[model samples]
Target chain A: MASPARGNHVWVGSETGILKGINLQKKQATNYKFGDAVLSRHEAVTTMCWGDPYESEIYVGCLDGSVKLFSTEKGKFTESRDCREGEGPFCGLAVLDGSLITCVQSGLLKVWRDTSSENVEIQVGPGVCRMCQNPEQLHRVATGGKENCLKVWDLHQPQEPIFRAKNVRNDWLDLRVPIWDRDMQFLPGSEKIVTCTGYHQVRLYDPSSPQRRPVLEATFGEYPLTALSLTPDANAVVVGSSRGDVAVIDLRQGRLVKCLKGFAGSVRAIQCHPALPLVASCGLDRFLRVHNLHQKRLEHKVYLKSRLNCLLLTSREKWENEDSPAELQSDVKEEEDDEIWNSMEVVATKRKAETQPCCESGNKEPRKDKPSRKKKIRKAES
Target chain B: MAEKLGKGRTSQKAQHNAEKAEAVASPGEGQGAPVQPDQVLFPPSFSVSEIKNKQRRHFMFLRWKQQQRKEKLAIKKKRKKEREALGDKAPPKPVPKTIENQRVYDETTVDPNDEEVALDEATDEFAPYFNRQTVPKILITTSDRPRGKTVRFCEQLSKCIPNSHVYYRRGLALKRIIPQCMSRDFTDLIVINEDRKIPNGLVLSHLPDGPTAHFRMSSVRLRKEIKRKGKAPTEHQPEVILNNFTTRLGHSIGRMFASLFPHDPQFVGRQVATFHNQRDYIFFRFHRYIFKNEKKVAIQELGPRFTLKLRSLQKGTFDSKFGEYEWIHKRHEMDTSRRKFHL
Candidate 1:
């Protein structure tokens, strides 16, 4: 586990196009720019996940429309093979049962079970915004997207999705599975799923409950919820809002536990360690904060220079090596040069930077304007 | 007489040898002139044919004596060379302590914040074996000489180990319900356990690392050096016995505690209630635990991030088990318990 110390190891991906790993142990960071090559090769790392159960593996989803698999054991860009095959930028990724599932912007879903097939691709669309699987039965799959659809595929039969739920989402096109409904599995099992949205509310539904609508709908008074996580015990729901704060809702009592303060930007994602009751939240502010649920203390906070789009923490001793934050030996130095180009352009395009990039450009900027204005008015009063 | 003579024979020879050694040494001082080549010369005594033989024999004897002299000189020179080398490289002679560097020992002068935090964190981890700084020991009379002596000893010892508790045989009847309590060690405190169990919660970590826990009162936390399993030398009798005893104790404790928690407890520790010098065990439960090792991470928030690998051994004499990292820590906790053994 990354020790939640002030210097805890963290992976920071810059808009300039480089993913750097931070090593809190050595008080150093090793970073390599996603070269015009690795960036153009596998550009725009929108999501980052630690792969290979032992942690020597790293799966990065690039907006350049490629899911690059890097091996820390081999200590270099293992290979920047285009898993999406120039389909489009990869938005999110999840590693299930030793197989890697990636959601791309072009509405294509691909699975790389192992390092083989540098050019293999699988297409499952709604522009696969997010992906998840039923842990109880690995065959049950859930893929959500821009079309307000949640397609559950049982790989046991790959040609057809076991069941598809339509009109599940109505807002943003990008969707990611931030929580698992382990409670929703059947007869002595559960299937309840709780999902957060760009739509200012969190909804819970049980596919097995045979209900078209959500069983529970949790809404926030202010900005839309960008990220949220349910406590392992399912007693509370922690949501990160567009207005830069993390709120803990006690579901049993149906009241606010406590809201953490001090982030300048919106919260992106929230996750809880299975064995730790603590809540970990990351977002536009690029700070990873861990809160001790019982003690109600934000135990530690690690600041990053760039926005954190997604994060997955599994027990891996070799995780920080994923980017080798401070490794001078990496041949990927060209990545930093590419990042320099992106950040400099972003610097020139502050107006666009203000507009959420994850929401995509042009149309979403106009849409994000109203909420950000409301946030400013509310911040002034609060 | 022969037997007696046999016993004293080496000594008698030694005594005579001493005399001979003395004789050889007395005139060997610098004042005595060293034998030179010219000091002793031989005269020729022989007839023509007979003379050749006699002269040859005499010459041989002279040559032999000269060689003996050379050998003696060489031996003497070698001893002189050895003494000179020893003078240059021999270890410095021990000098009696001058008492200049020795100073009065005082532990209270450290930064209180860091000390408190470190002690709290460590004692929290090794909670069960911790001896706290508060809690005054009220000695009871029936508490035979041993009990009172132990209490007095602990009063001084507990200052060193911050998480430990000693009841000290207070004559008060063992009551099941008692809510009233105060920190009697001249410190401000309050009651924790509403039940009759010990006031201190067994720190799943309140354990000392082996015998190192015994000296914990000095507030120095030490980890026991675990010898690599396969490489440990087994030829020594003491090590073999100690290894077997600790191995069984560890396996038994791990099994017993694993059953108690069924689920990984918030805390970890082994509890020993000593009465009549015998120990009955109890496992400490925790409020929270954070563990990170190789392979699996069983976080409370995520459950088990990876497959939980736990290896356990049932209670059977002479049983030793090497489990996964998860069980290894628990077994470590078990082995940490102070076992009553013949010192």
Candidate 2:
């Protein structure tokens, strides 16, 4: 599992009920859709998790309260099961030692045993936005959302949460701070769990500490801090806001290091490469962008037409050469050239013909006459 | 006649003094006493008829004329004294400070020949507090491998947006196109990447400044699905309706989405952009109106209707691996309920 050459496929789930596998080596993407006729048309893939360490089996949770199992190697859905009705969409999904773990927006966390009909269920709290499992301690998961403060649940205990975060004291205005943890992540080797809130706050809470409140808190953009990801080095956290502002915050100092700009809409999901100094992000803008964290340059960008919901980054190295055939590359380039020329030719020819004489004459007469003609048309219409 | 006149003058003087004494004693109620003397002196008395003989009448007329002249002289002297007391100053101008007494300056009083007052240049006093003005110009283009469906989707999508322009991504590097787009003042760029002739990937880059986001589109159901559900209305032309976005953020988001489509549709264009929400998922549908004549019309599928689910959003360009990059995940959580979100 620790090997670096395991796979380089980036799996992305979309609102259109399709799962896409992007082969980094080949620069190719393949879409996988379930063949089941009973699937609801409006059902969107909400949450996904790897079922096995080999990264072959994937469990997908849909908005329609159904969980489906897919084999990455086979590229087909193998099993599907309906969750409790009216649970809303799955807010989080994970796999712990062959048991399927799922959490819904209404805060019903369930663990389904592969062989037994019985399942373990716990109510984390209502309005739960996200749940994240600690890689080191798979049984421990953190859940938080609106009115649902941070809680660390140990699956083996199956009772009360091990750690429940208390709300911070009222702000300087003496107003109670709202609890809306949009995203959370566990530090690599520490008990500290960092959570980003809709209030644009990033807070680190150590369950081991005596205090229930966050040990450190920092704010980012003014808009809701929709999503956050831990840097590979674990020294910084990347946070995105509803207004499309993304920034890196130094965890030790609780200060923003830099901000990343270029988003028109709200940011939805972001991920940092586990081993590489790379970060891949997707959003309502529907473009998958891979940025080099060290150089702060966009390495690769692919436009996926539909709004993406979630993305999974693989550990396999990027395909720099050899996998993408020369023929396909050339073909892609030709098609792109043709597209540009088709649109540009029309505009360029027309503009050049019209502006060439105007430039040669170096007079404002032609420009003035153009408006006069338009004025005459308006007069005629009137 | 002289004795009668003397008696009348003595009574008038006594009445005036009585009114003055009343005014001094009861200031509040004395306002009514000054009016009573005028009412009492106006009527003529018949007791004066005895002085009507011819010679006596002539003497009485002379005496009356002389008394009237003396009264006029006294009034003139009194007025002169009052003027001297006031130091010959001009009459006090009325100050309209109270609501009832306030004056409204009418536009008609303005001097037409007065030079036009120059308006102060719009200050940036509120600029820091207010969101910057962004022109909603969107550039719709396709990915390098342009499929027919994706190209057509770009065309139809561009039409839906009011100030959008569509061009195929002819192998033109985004770097090159971005400068061009910036020069053209395009605020947004939407890239449609196709897989297997299906609109698969969507890249929306905010120009000049960007937190470019990529989305994966799936479960595309065209207008045929709406028609099958019997939800398509009987209209000759396609109409885009964005519904159920109630909050200010929702409204602005809806408006931002609506601004992506052209405000005025071309005569031949029939597509509509409908963004309706149920729960939290906003469903985007594009439909085309097919009409044989004026009477019978049918709805046809133009562009692929799909739902947009946010996957990831990065802060700047996709260059996170090099220097430093920050991003956020689970952006969809912010869209769940409008009440809690400030955006």
Candidate 3:
């Protein structure tokens, strides 16, 4: 599928061995299945990102355990089956300087990039997903998974992370933190990450200084905050919640800008315009709302048909100022005709019934197994 | 259910004190509230033996949580700028300690083992229920406590409606003194029990008005009377004997308070065991402290129509124990939550 960001082009890698360029401007885009149609297994798209500058060479992660390279130039994709199956079920894919970092569910992360001699590329791996190149020291990169401590590998000595940051033994830190780290932030233009827990407090940490404690923690919300996004400038963090309340915590002030409330469900995803202060959040409410982080009001709401399991927002503009309340009120009315919101009642009812288990067979097992496991792991490990 | 429940209309409100009920109670006792005919009225009465023993631990835990959160916030504010400048160079500062008093209103456990343990300890000296021999001279109405456990729920008691005066003074030994204040209005001498305002169906404890203590007291008093008279005191020993005395007094004073007397009852609840065969009613879940030692104390709820369900106590327990008296059961039903210490 086309990348959700501002770029007009996308690297579409389909399960049918199809790697193609899909133009958003055109109604009829071209398609080319990289392999014979008969060999396609219709695998799930594991991960995809705008991995290139020109927006070409779409990196497609597939469940079948391989990354496919789709070129917009050829209008077709090629598979790097060189990586064996089960070696990765890469859930995350990010591109830094033409080098690819793939985060697999099995806790293994690999970096693939060209070395000298151009085509003679090095595929370094068997490491965790804590991979990030030191902007100050390009040769020095780090890798860690949620399960393993981070290890920094210099192109010269690619062994372990430079030094272990004595993080609270939380599973998320134990592994490379998630794409949306709810607890804290990683400082801008640096390798520092922040985390928060218990009453929605934020804590900042710089792994470079592992033994030292965090720098700042801004507390907000009356309950547990479930999601967080950085303002494009990285000065303030837009925190979201287990309840659909959102707030902007200005680090300079060490206080919450506002506690925004509207949605009835816990927030699941948060994204802000790269330049514009507009923030888009979607959650169990199934409604994607765009708000001016400053005005902190519902600007636009796009009703999705699902509970909005996940979303990606890509904007090129930077946020400049706060929004006015009057503008927000009018924008909210425009969403009244939103058909996605029109189906919410029915969707909620359907969801409720499916969630409750009917006594099945003669043997009625305790319904708590899955629910308990999730609760236990979250409370114990996280 | 809403229509069936009548509102509270008390004209005479009193505070509790270190005295027996018969001494403070008029023939028609209460907060001088006229008992509504349709409502089952009663006092907020229960066995203090339950909570004084089994549930203080849980109450203490909640107090600790409140204290921790307060300290954490204060220290954080003081160290904010300094720490941010250090930027991970220095360790995070610890939470400060500024918060003071916290209160608790919930009590879950009231089993025999714990009460027995308490009975063996200090309660035997202070509470009369354990021995079922001593007539308790003091009735302590409390909401909850925190100021280092040095005071009763006096803070909460002050908030008790019918806006009353409250008191608090540690004893000579620096022991906790449940504050009781004197007043001239409806809340006069009223020390409100703050526990009533709690959010949940509060598992509250009070001085048990059970027949066990009454039975033992009555039996012992009557036994001595028969021995002194050299004849068997009649079947209705205590009731008959006390009635002659209180009846004359109940009516003459009834005339004096004719203008102040209650016409209706304000209470709710049917008979049910809450803590293992312990009978409790919702009506009298709140009580009154009418004119005692110049300091009146009472227990009352904050809202109307609090929903609650019984946990372990059964319906038949009271029946089997006091099977001989139909009036006791009827009165128990009416008495548990009824406000009609009816004239």
Candidate 4:
């Protein structure tokens, strides 16, 4: 179990309470069941997150209000604790500096520390759908749900929200627009928060701005969007809808970029690689699919034999191919050379002479030579 | 072909020489060509429809069909004789290709001995029904203002399953009806939707908790429409036969159909309910059987048969707007291959 779990690229939580580890390089899947009891939906994993930056440990939150800690090194569950503060299944799970943060559907958010007396419990609001931590600022976490607007709380303060999003204006009919933020992510380099709502809208909120409402809003397909993840470049987001439509939406232009196909059910979770152009998604279709973001092509599809609830993609680089690191190093060296060339100045006449044909011939030479060269080669062969 | 068209639109004398010249030169031109050797044996292009005289064309077509049949029979006879002569040394016969036999490989096909699938089935929504913990009490309703044919179809379906009740929809929302059904101890809710006086959709939702299945219902035949159907079904429980439900999704669907009936079947009634799935279409049939002799059995079809194609399977009860779908039939994406089947 330790050997198989070591190189796994993705970890998917299924509705059957089985934690599946998939090694994309080997095309092998290993299932880790916690106990000897009968497999039941009561213990189905509702949410999962890495316990630390190294991703060696996993925190699995189940529907039965138990949070089990799994160590990838040992390939076994190390600890299990009942987070019984909430009334419903866990909506989200996160780890901040070795402490565990869990939020349930009943709006109970609890922070568990090494000492029981230091535990902090906060009620964000009722009907909370998701609670996610800001990666850049470890202490900041956001919570939103049905009828619950986006609220970013500073865990250090715990008294008031640092940033609270106001609801968008009413529709043309003068009725209040609904609020159902199914999933959200914090942009890496900025204070902007991107969220996908159950009403099929993708909204970007800038906490640093004076306005409390979302600055940019874009709607995708008709069905409610269930999950979303930002691309590695952080310029676009991949959103999945309840009707199995997954598309990349450009955050800057608020435009649809490209749609990834071959999904047959509602997408429950999507996690994009932090560096690679790949996105892994799993849903009720019972298949985990990895799509290449650049090519927009499905790369791998594995049938895990149960409805999937959540997904976690490894942030490790060079997992797809071992030889990629050498190529990436050469690319970095070439970029450095290009920077040196750009820094040097040249005489005005020589620069004009060097740049004119380079620009004109670069575009014209290929068109003029390609067909004629092919014809000459054909004639010589004949 | 050109001559035949010209012969209809204008006088026969007009373009008669050109038509004759072309038709006479066409076959000669084919024979003269070096690229097409088969053109010598057959004309370049000729169809019976191009023949001007309808009577003569019909006669020629019939004779051609008969000749083809004769050739096929001759090949069969020759093969059989060769096989008989070399009975001990004949090679194995080649299997014919069929859509089912050449079906695309489905990774989700359940292996009976697989422990995970068995465990999954054991704890699914149908576990109580399969474990005999909950008695099967079905409430069959129709879309509001159901027509006579759909109405009669539901009535006939109720007769086939024991402990099933047919209820009028009475213009109530299914969401509202679900809570009322749960309080009354209903184990299943089946709603038949009709369009243009014909039943076109069927929604089967498991009660209390659900994995609701929506199916496109077609080719519905009532009792009076069936030719030589048996009498109205008896009240005793009938044995259920589910065929070709091989995949994981198919297993769930098969279990849903199986749970609609009681646990113990009454053999004395000799009644059977079969849900036969082929190429993703489920055919429902009720029959009564009797063994006449050791090797011979007679079966009579009961009333009301229909075909169902699964449209979607939702995780919860009757919330299309917000409910998550387990599997959905996307015609453009999923139906790209003819030999591919979901159930």
Candidate 5:
């Protein structure tokens, strides 16, 4: 079970309180539950995140206000903890230096430490739709929701937000535009955060910039956008609407890049591979679909049999490898060897033209020329 | 008796084949291949259409049609005679091919013994109805200012559904109406939307919480429009029949339709309402049956029949803009293969 769990490329959290591990190569899905307890909607998984950089430990937050720790190494739930401070389902979950950080829909964000007395808490705001931690800066996290604008907080000081975003200007009718950031992601290599709104708009917020309002904003379909994931390059963002419309929108010009097809329902969660041009999305349709971002082709689709809310994708380059870095190094060695062979061919051509022709003309005789000459060179090299 | 049945079947098959051939011949003629049929019938590719005189051409075409029919009848007669002579040793009749039989294999077809799917269905929104914890109280209405057949259709629909009430829309939004209906102890809401006085859309929202389903309604035949429909239905509850709901999506739709009616049907009413699914289109029929002796049963069609093709299934009640959809039909992407069906 542990070995097969390690082979899984995607881990999906479903509404039926089942954790599904899908191995794309084998086209198999394995369901993992916590205990002998019957599956219930109260324990429905709402958010999931890696507990460490190694991606071996997963922290799954449930609607019932408890967080379960799943170890991919053992392919089982190793520990279950209660973080019932929040009023609603968890909006986001992250781990920082062994400490678990959880934010709920009712805006209760807490940091769970080894000791109960040491845990820190912060009130982000009411109706927190989503909270996401910055991958580069583990201490930084952002929160946003309905009628609540974007706010970035530093975990070091939970007193107040470091950067608070202001809502966009009113519309042409001089009416206030509603603010609802359904899902958000932090752009790697930068402080810019991209968010998809319930108003069907995708807004990019740059905390480094002076303007608190969105640096750029773009709208896609007519329905509310539920989920968004940044592409590996981070030049464009993929957003899925409540009506199951998934599209990639360019950040630079805010232009629509392309649309992914074959989605039957509203997409709840979307995750793009950290390095590969592949994005996996799952939703109310109960199907986990992985699409090629470059070609916009649906590559793999697995029927999970329950509504999916969140998903975590393995970041390893080679899925079949137990230790991917070692295999990657071996791959690099093959490329280096090919380079050396190419350079040797160039040297052989230069030597043949510069020396072989001159020697043949001077002798005016071909006495075992090709074989003896190549053998002599080989002998000299050895 | 067997020989007569065999003869009738053969005649039907021959007539069907002739009709198909005629259809093919008409298309060939439209493409300027007037001699196509003549080429098949004779070695010399001479067509009656090539005749200079219009009267002669018409006369020759009539003669050709008669000849084709006579040849078809003779062939059918020969096959029938051969089958009759064989008697009990006759070959089994060939089964006809249809898109339903040739459907693409659906991976989500629910197996009865599948524990996960059984648990899922047991905990779904309609679980209360299946568990008999809540009684079905349906509220049927129409789009604001419904006219003509749309209004009458809702009235007839309400008659078959026990504890159902038909009301006017009054132009109120569905989002606002849902809360009031919940407070009023209504378990389900049915909204019939019409375009140009013709019912074209049906929205069924399981109340309080949902899994609202939207369907494209077509081919409406009200009592007045029907040729030989039965009288007005009685107040007694009708038995509900759901057919061909095999896939997971289809199962959910079937369960939704089932929850709209009462659990224990009044058998004394002798009326049955059926939602038969064929190639993804759901055909609704309400009928009254009479048990003719112990061996035979005859059914008479009650009024108001229509067809429904699923458009979308939303998660929560009537919030089309914000509610998450469970399944939505994408015409271009999903309809690529005629054999592929969602429900």
Candidate 6:
């Protein structure tokens, strides 16, 4: 019987428009290139979403407004489609109920179907920085940005936002507060939405509440917060700033739990493992680092040599029973061959030295050398 | 007896051979000059003044004197070159004057016998207006002509001010923009006018009041100068320095200016912005940081430093004529006059 693949693989999107799959167990990375010259050099992979719950197909959004679907099994791009003209360089992508949903920076959210020419389009707002889908309620998505505060939209309704964030009242100085939400995520099992802003603020908005403003507001470093991810337990969120500072903020207390160091560039994407207490992050620094949440130690680090924009972690259960027995057997045979070859080199050198001086007495020397060659014969047999 | 004699002869011969080998191996050691008894012995103590006199006449002292003379000659040559460059127009000497002895005319220090005082008295009849608030609430806006660069410039300026906001003109008339500003309660308004896709004019107006200043901005460039040499490291954080600000008020003003530009995104690990003020002109220097380590920071100029100058100042609200440009003429006129102004 074959042993299962021991660890999960991380999929990353690079700035050169390449999709990379890194196997943590083998420390091997495989680059999947698009066929037919589809992706240009300047077309960076901006956003990515899995097509199905099984994650067999991945939808990758590019900077040139093209969305390519890649097959995880075949390790190649299966199809490509262009969004409406002047619509993309998508900020977010999601596959819900077999339909493709793409949100552009200009706040055009479009839902496309495979067989129909008709598409549902909604204008969220201009300067939309991020659009995130609620994992619990797949039909609901949130969008926010510069002038466009936070708004949760329902695909079923498609007309207006379900929850629109009202701008906070005038500050203590009676000045209107500016709104700039850079990234947001939905808290699991709740109607609350957590958003990080360019103003260096992390705010949590509960739509179920009567109030329209954020219920909890916390400030981080002076720089803008670029990306954030909820922990598996949903009690805390890991926020990364443009200054490369990453910290876990407690949701209940609105206090910082701990800061994870070692980032030198703006962190682009961060995600925590669903099954294990591990958080994997990638950024402009071109490194994918997996950190243990409990131990606070880096578990694995791989340099992809390209600025990474997005990453997805494969399900850990699928890792089990994934490695084939035939490959493992071949690997063992190759190691044995290497060992035999190394020993053969030493035996050949010894034989040459003995044969050079005994050329005249070669026949007698061969009979005498037979006794001294026992070790070489035994090594070859093994 | 004969056996013992033979062994003794052989040992003596071996010793002589060893001695001969040592002599041949190190001839310089054997031929070294003999040391004098006085040289090996410590010298008698001398007085400190006597030692100093002897040292002053030594070759080391002469070498020091020569180096000093060379430096003095170089300094003299540089001064002579500067003087030659200046020609006949040397900087005027500063005249020392005491506050009590200084004569005042039209609330300005002037010579008692000056003939221009009568003419200046007519200008001093108007009272000065002051906006007392220290912290500024600014609204940054671009001209009706909207371009990508202008919008980006407006966005950068908005980020520089903590309480400021960016609003694109989007072909909206000033009549419509004013009401929106009033509703939003913006204390000040800044409009950047672009000509041929280049920012050439800036209009600063106090909201709900008059007196707008127009400035001419020249030499606008974006990230055109920043060049990425190698792979940007993971830990690079851009450093921001606002230089040449003096007191606490100046520090606050410097901070307000620094807040106009967005936090360095640090995409290439070396983006830096330096705002340096000399006299009334502010020079903006944007560059890429080159750091070998924490202690070594190298600045590679990314683009040409931009210089801003005040072109014109209107007395009252942007287009309306009401107050005189006394604030521009004398910055401390309001503080000294103790007059109240309505906004």
Best by DockQ: 5
Please, what are the lDDT tens digits per residue for candidate 5 over residues B98-193? 898889999999999998889889998999899999999999998899997888899888887889999889999988889999999999999999
Once superposed on the true structure, which residue ranges of model 1 sit more than 4 Å away at CA? A1-9, A23-29, A32-42, A72-76, A85-88, A113-128, A166-189, A251-255, A316-382, B1-343
Higher-DockQ candidate of 1 and 6: 6
How many steric clashes between backbone atoms does each model show?
60, 69, 76, 0, 0, 11
- Which stretches of candidate 2 lie above 4 Å from their native place? A1-8, A36-41, A115-117, A317-382, B1-343
Candidate 5 chain B: worst-modelled 10 consecutive residues by lDDT: B24-33
Q: Give the docking tier of candidate 3.
A: incorrect
- CAPRI level of candidate 4: medium
For candidate 3, lDDT tens digit of each residue in B37-130? 4665444343232335456645544543454465467557757866887897978565664211121211212233542222222221213323
Kindly list the per-residue Cα lDDT of model 1 for residues A1-382, writing each as its tens digit.
Answer: 2222212245545433456555544545454554444332125467767664445567776766555665554444555656654355555566777777666656565666666674234456644556665656755656665544555666656677665553444447566433211111111146656665555556665677676566666666455566667766676787776556577776555467787654444565676655567666766544566677777686666654344566544433332333322222221342335566456775636633543343244345568898999999999999
Q: Mind giving the per-residue lDDT tens digits that candidate 3 earns over A1-382?
A: 2221123222333333333332232322243444654333334354466555434456666667766676543445655644332355554565666776665655554556565243212233442332344445555554444334434455544444444544443454466332222333345687765444434666565666645444565677665565667788888777776545578877666687776655544565566666777776766443556787777777665433223323345442311110222322322332444566456778646633543332131123335476887899999987
DockQ of 1: 0.00
lDDT of 2 by residue, B247-268 (tens): 3234334444554443344546
Docking class of 2: incorrect
- Model 5's alpha-carbon lDDT is 0.87
Can you write out model 4's per-residue Cα lDDT over B62-134, one digit (the tens) per residue?
A: 7655644664686699799999999989999999999999999999999989887788889999999888799
Q: What is the interface RMSD of candidate 4, in Å?
A: 0.9
What DockQ does each listed candidate score?
0.00, 0.01, 0.01, 0.61, 0.65, 0.02
Q: Docking category for candidate 1?
A: incorrect
Give me the TM-scores for chain A across all models, comma-separated. 0.65, 0.79, 0.54, 0.83, 0.84, 0.82
Native contacts recovered, each model: 0.00, 0.00, 0.00, 0.72, 0.89, 0.00
